[model samples]
Structure formats: C-alpha cells, structure tokens
Target: MTTLFDRFERAFMPNYGVPPVALARGEGTRVWDVDGAEYLDFIGGIAVTSLGHAHPALVEAVSTQVATLAHTSNLFLHEPEVKLAERLLALLEQPGKVFLANSGTEANEAALKLAIKYGKTTGRSYFVAAEMGFHGRTLGSLSLTGKPSIRDQFGPFATDVRFVPYGDADALAKAVDENCAAVFLEPTQGEAGVVPPPDGYFAAAREIATRTGALLVADEIQSAIGRTGHWFAHQADGVVPDLLTLAKGLGGGLPIGAVVGFGAAGTIFAKGDHGSTFGGNPISCAAALAVLDNVDLEHVRAVAERLRTGLEGIAHPLLNGVRGRGLWLAAVLTEDRAAQVQTAAQQAGFLVNAVQPDAIRLAPPLVVTPAEIDTFLAAFPAILTEAHHG
Candidate 1:
C-alpha cells in the first residue's frame, strides 16, 4: 500500500534522497516505523532529541504553552521567551546578552554579522576559521565552514576568510592577525568525525584571539545542550569565548537557536542590525525551557560515559579505538567501511550514522539506559563481521 509519506515525497525536494524508513512514532530511546517495526535509535535525530521523542515534560510544556500563548512578535515581550533566555544565561554562568534565532544556521549568521560589524568599527576586515569545520548552510556561515566541497559551489564569498588546521594552536596563532575580526571553531568537531581537539587547545585558541584582538566564537550547535554531557562542551576546557552559538538539542525537538555575546562584543549591534520573524516565538522558547529543565546534567553525563566505554569494547579486526567526549562518540574503524557498518546495523534493527567514510558516530538520547548500551555492544561484533565479509 502506498503510504502518505510516499505521496508527500513526490512533491518535496530530493535533497535528502529517499528515507529508508518512515518513522511513525517515538518514545524515549526507541522509535517505530510506518509499518510498526521497532528499532533502537542511536542517531537521536542528529543529536537534536536530547530528551528523546514524546518526552512528557517536553510534550506538556509545548502543549500548555501553545494553548496559552504560542507566538508574540519581537514588537512585544513574552514570558516564556524571557525566561528561556534567563535560563541559558544562568547555565552559561557568564555575564552576557542573548540574541535568539530559529536555528543553528541563523545563530551563526547572527554571530557572523556581529563579527562584521565589530570588524568595521575596529578597522579589521578579515576572519579566520578551521578546516573541516561545519558551521551551517547559510551564505555567511557557509563562508566560515572550511569544507572545500561545501564552499566550492558558493564561490566569490565574503572576503578575507582564512582556513587553518584544527587543533593546531601554533598554526592558528600564526593565522590570526591585527586585521582579523574573529576566529570561529567547534570545541569538538562533531561533523568532521567527532574529533576533539588536543588538551588545552581551547586555551591556546583563546590566547591567540586575545593577542590578535579577535573575538573567539565557539559553534556548539551539535555538541551543546547535554549532547556531550555538558551544558556547553567548551565549559570542560574552562575557556570563555567572546561569542557562543547554540542550537540542535536546545529545544529538545522544536527549532530554536541563540548567539550569546560577552562584554563589548555583546553590544556590537546597536540597533537595526539583525532581526528575525520567528526567532524567539514563545512556543519554541517554552519547548527549549522544558528541555533544559528535564535534561538532568548528572544523568546525561553518567549515561554518556557508560556508552562511550561500551563502544570501546567492540572487538573486531576492522575496529579501531573509539574517540569522543560523552555520548557523542565516533567508532574509528580500520578501513573505510563506516558506510557498510551503518547499513549492517540498520538491517539488524538499529539506526546508526556514518559521519565520514571511516568514522561511525553514535549520539543516542540522554535517556538511553545501560541495558541498551549493553545490547549495542553485544550486537556490534556481528555487525562488524557482516560488514567485513559482505
């Protein structure tokens, strides 16, 4: 029987190709497809479902907020939006101001705009970024993204943007100069195979930014909101950047993003600089508040650590060591067979993702249990074997 999803796909863009399974409903760490086949969810909607699907707290918060007050334009103030901003500022534990948006890309776009405005005032024109860093899809964010393939099509981009080697502090120091406005980096490169920088790299970057008078921006779209067992991954390094961009799991499942600025950087945009139509709608803010309230930091940390260790125990010739901080783990395989492993795992009633040809990333919901980790570990060897010989 032809499903509604099949009909819907006929008119939608083909950018995502054809989804293998039409997900129907979800609860906690598991989901069922349209035909009602159950599977363990490891991708967690690319780390956006921090509290998992249909979490009662999120559901009730969203339902209540929508019923009470869904949206109020920036022309007026709303309680949920104000409260959510306060909550984020409190969690950051830093004196700062917030500029809310609707997605990570928009948050980065705001950050980029801030950089440009600040640069103009300071007589600086250039910006520096790192290679393999995935910022976002918008033009300004795309300019900062260091992936050649992503940038290739959008040539003649914003000028004076430099790309450097990630985790190479010396190279970064040499790259940023007096004419540079800002330096953007991911605390841990999530899309570039869950690669965490060397110890003290964040401090080194901060020093370089300070020396050059460039604003330091941390893009935590994928690694923030307890995805890596921390409110913000850079907090683990004790380095406070000039600007921080957040999204992904911020709203549990709803769409929301924010750019936080400190001191002078926070006030760069005087007025009429940037604005959004649905940036801080009460509905999204309420959803994000519920996510923050329900995502217990201690529980997330324990589960993430347990799962990280379990992934290291997968025994196979093609298996290499696992690398990541918290639940955001990537299995480094011996060969470029990450795609094969992903397919095998899917066939075995699991949903995993291959961030790169040789790296398999696991970012399950924070609610996943130890028993689920054990199940994954037990099934891992066979998944590897199936991929190796097939």
Candidate 2:
C-alpha cells in the first residue's frame, strides 16, 4: 500500500523534507497520526496554533466567515479586517495603523518596505538587526536574519542590513548611526532556540534608535499574542517600537500577519506603497479575532509557571536549564542531543521541537490543561533517559 508520506514526497516540494509522521487530527493539546498513534502536542504548530487544533472558537469563526464571505482582495473592504486591526491596536494601547498580511515573513517584508520608505525620507539606507536572530525566510526578512547558514546561499539580497550581537546594548548602540534607517530586534530570538536578550536591551535599542533618528522595529512574530504572558513581548521592557511585526499564534492556526506602525512610522507609507492579494482576507481576520477573544493571558501565565517549575524541578543530568517566557519555552540539554531526545519523545507519544541541536522548544497551546502538562512532566525524565542511553 502506498502511504500518505509516500504520496506527500511525490507531490510536495522538498524544502521541508519528509515528515516523520502524518498527522490525522487533533483536539486541545493532543494529536493523532494517520496510524492512530496519539501524542501530546507541545509544539502547537511552531507556535501557530494558539488555541490548539479544532478549537471551538477558531472553527466556528473560520467556518462562519468562510461561508459568509471569504476573499475580497485588496480592492474591497471587509468588516473582519477592520475589527481585527482595531483589536490589535487596542491590545497595544497605542495609536497606530495596521497593515495585514498572510504570514510572519510577509509582515516582516512589509516592515522592511516601511523602513526603506523611512530611509528615503531621512537620507538613511542601512538597517541593524541582531546576530543569531531570525525574522523570516523571505528575501527581505532573510537579509535581516543573522543566521549565515540559512541565508548565505540565497543572497545577494537587496537590503543593506547590518548584523549586531544580540542582547548587547553597546553593539546595538554602535550599529545604529545617523545613516541607519532602522534597528530590527526580536524581543526574544525565537528561532535561536528561544533565546532572550539581556534585561534593558530593548530600552537601550529604543533610546539608540531615537537618538539616531531611526525607526525601531520589533519582530514579535513568535513572542506576541499572549505567548510571552503579554500582549507583545516588548511590553516586558516597556518600550514601544516604531514598527512592530506580528504573526504565528495571531490567527490560532489560519494564516495571518500584521505590522503596526506607531506615530511617524504610521504615516511613512504613501498611497500604493505595497499590498497583498490574500492579506486581511475575512476568514483569516475572523480567525484572528476569535483568538484574541478567547486567549486567556492569566491562564497562560499560570500554566507557564507550572511547566517551568516542573522542568526546573527535574534532576536529570542531561538537563541544563530552561529559556523563554510564558508558554514559549526551550529545554536546554547538557549535550547536543536534542534530535535524539525529540525522536525518543515521539516514541514515547509526545510532540516537541528540536529547535536546535541542544534545545527542545515547547510551545503548546494556551488552552493546554494542567493535567496535560503534568503528563508531559512525568514522562520527560524517562524520555531524557531513553535519549541519553539510546
């Protein structure tokens, strides 16, 4: 019999490689493979499924909106788009203009354009981004990304982006001079094994950007929308970015992205600056609205605390520590055995992400229950043991 993976390998692009298992369905914090093997879901679709799979609110919003009205292109206006933009701005508690897109990369691409336009007006042409930080995989965003391994082959990119050491205030200060158009920072470097910057780093970046007359762009693609126990991760530093990019967990699963430009940055874009065909489509916007409506920040914080505490309490020799905030955590291993650990976890019926060779990222849905967390915590030591020995 031809398996689903065989069919997928035949039909799909090879960028993602062949996945280990073919997922059939999911509910809350659990998923089942095509073979009927069940697993506890901790990755949450790389932090995209904010409400878990088949969530009631997400399902209803998507179903209702798709049935009522779906795509209208940018040529027409829709109520869901307006409502979603308003809600995002409201959550920010700032006056801003929102540009919606289909994914985080698109959001970052839009932000890069805004930075370019700002540069045009200010006579500046360069951007400063953190080393080991990730914005997205698209050309513009990938140029801003500091990882040379993933980005080096695809370039020569068009953007003049400078790389600075992440969490180092002095390096950031030195990089953003008068000729710099923007300074892009991720509140927490998500793709770099969920690494966070030193305290006061964002504040210093804001000060530096202001002094140098550059736009401060926060790429909150992975750390926003209650993932970090805040509306946005930059809130932890109490610094308001000139431009903020958001996605991943924004739509609970359906693809959506947004860029919020505050104050002067909001007005930089002129008519016909940039646009997207599927951006802000009613279905995605409605799904995002449902995510905003149902995501409980307080519960998110509590569960995060429990999970963190449980992780920290484990006395395994292979355990190094934990990184990140709220539900977006990475378990640091003493050895570079994250891939082995991930395979062991799968065999033990749990889903986790080997984000790096030495780190396993855990970004479960906000609605994941205490019991579910406890189940993972209980099985984790054995999983580690199996990985260590196997």
Candidate 3:
C-alpha cells in the first residue's frame, strides 16, 4: 500500500535509512505500528520518552498549555517557563543560570561556545573530551564528540578539541592544565554501549579541573532525568561539575535542551553571548514540568532495583552482565549479535536497540509495569536463541 511514510521517504533525504516500522499510537510502554501490530517498547524513543509514550500527565500538561499559551517570545516571560527553570535548578541541587535550546546537540553547541568564550578570557583555547563520548551532531558539539567515525567528513570542526580516554583520571589530569578551557565527560557513556566509568573517576576529574583552573563539564544528556535511577548520574560520585548539558528526557518527548552553568561558570558568558528563540517555549516547559512532577526519585530508584533483579534471574550465555544504574541498562551480548538480538526481540513482540555491536541497550519508559518486565524476562531465552542461531 502507498502510505504516508512511503511518500515521506520518497521526498526526504535518505540519511537515517528507511524505518522498518511506522509507529502510529502509544500508551504507557506499548506502541502500535502503522499496521496495528503492538510491541513492548524498550528503547523509549532512544531514551527521550521519560514517562513513556503518550503518558497521561504529559498529554494533559501539553494539551492544556498549548490551548492556553503555546509560545511567548523570550523577550517576555511566562509562568510555566519560570516554574520549569526553578524546578530544574532545584533538581540539579545547584545555583546556576540556564540557557535553553531545542535539542542535546544545540545545548552542547551553546555549552561549547560558552567554554570557548570563557577560555578566551583565560587565554586558553583548547578543550578536552572523553573517548567514545557522544555529545551531539552540530558543528560545535560534533567537534566535541570523541568518535572519529561520526566526525570523519564533518571536519574543520570547531577546533582545539583534545580527545582523551574516558574514565582515565590520570590521562585527564595529564591533559588538563592552566592552558585548557574545559574537560567534558559523560557520566555514563550512553551511545557507546552504555559504558559506566570507573569509581571516583568524575570526582577525580573535578579535582584535576580545580587544580588546573579548567572547567569541568558533564554531558548528562542521556544519563540525566532519572534515566540512571538518579536525577543526574554524577550525583552517584558526589561531584558537581562546573557546566552540565541536559536534554533527551527533559521535555517529556518534546524538543528542549538546557546548558546549566554553575557558580563562577555562569558568569563567564556576558550579555548577548548566547540565545535561542524556541528554547524554552511554554509548551515544552509545561511538558517537562509534567515529567518532573510524575517521576519521584525514590520511585524511579525502586523501578531500577526491580529491573536489575529481574534481569539477573534471566539466564543466557550471550547475556554476560547487565550494566547500568536505573532504566538505562545495557545487556552485554556476545560479539556482534546485538543487532540480531534486537531484531529477534522486536519480532517477538518487543522493541529493543543495538546501541553497539556487543551490547543491547534498554532504556524503557519509567512507567513500565512489573508485568512488562516479566514479559521480557520470559521471552528473553527464545529471543537470544533466535538471534544466535537463526
């Protein structure tokens, strides 16, 4: 049948390839494809759907806010915007200034620009980012991304970015000096196989940055917003970074991102340094506020605990170790069969992702019920068998 998706692919650039399934509707952790086939969604829109697809709270907030006030220029303030900023600040557990944008890449772009501006004053032009880190896809953020494959053709990127091995405190200390502007790391490396850093790595990085007068930046775009069972993954290490970039789940499936500058870091950018037109639109703020209100930290933590226990009980040779904090977990599969596993799981009425060749990442909606977990557990062995030997 000639469908809307087919028409879309015929006209649009073939950048992401053709999507296999065209999703039409969703409720909680389940989504219906255009063919009306239901599947248990575990990818959660690549971790963007915090409370899950079409959550009631998010629907109510977005619907009401859109009807009342969809957008007001940044020149004038709105109540929801003010309230969202305050709420994020409170959740961050820090005093800072926020610059809002429409995506993680944009947020990182603003942050990189801010770092460069601050570096200009300090007479240091170089910034360091960790290896295998996925910041974003824009020029500035792309330059900061540590993966060479993603940066291959986009070069002459915002220059002076140094790539350092992730979780290596000594390497960061060796690279960071008075001449360095900032050191950026993802508390939990999301796109690179859900890699968790070594213990005390972030804290040690903070100490190194302090000693060297370089700003410490944590790109928590994927690991923040209760994804790792914590408001921010860095909280587990008890270290606060100078600059933090947030997105992904911040807008509850809407488009929004934020660059939060802490303490002295906030003062680096003077007036007119950075701005965005649709960064903090009232509708986006309302959706984010609804996400915040629906997710309690304690409840999310409990959900993580339940998932960990359930996954541990499911046995398979390919399933080595499940690594992650909260809902952001990666099931370690043997070799490069992760893609096959994702395919098998999907065909078996579940949705999953192969974020890496050797790992399957599962960032299910926070609203996923215990029964959903049980369903996955029960069907896991067959999925693995099909993936391994199909």
As for model 3, its CA RMSD to the true structure in angstroms is 1.2
Off by over 4 Å in 2: none
Candidate 3, residue 199: the lDDT equals 92
Poorly placed runs, candidate 3 (over 4 Å): none
Q: What's the lDDT for residue 278 in model 3?
A: 92
Candidate 1 residues lying further than 4 Å off, grouped into runs, are 1-9
- The CA root-mean-square deviation of candidate 2, after full C-alpha superposition on the true structure, stands at 0.7
- Tens-place lDDT digits, model 3, residues 1-390: 889788879988999777777899999999999889999999999989999888888999999999999988778789988898899889988999888889999989888888898888889889999889999988889899988889878998757889899989889889999999999899989999999999989999999999989999999999988888888888888999999999989887999999899998877788777888898999999999999998777767777788788788778878887887788999888668998999999899899999999999998888888788888878988999899898
RMSD in Å for candidate 1, one decimal?
Answer: 1.2
- Candidate-wise lDDT, in order: 0.90, 0.94, 0.88
Candidate 3, pairs of clashing residues: none
What TM-score does candidate 2 get on C-alpha atoms?
A: 0.99
lDDT of 1: 0.90
- TM-score winner: 2
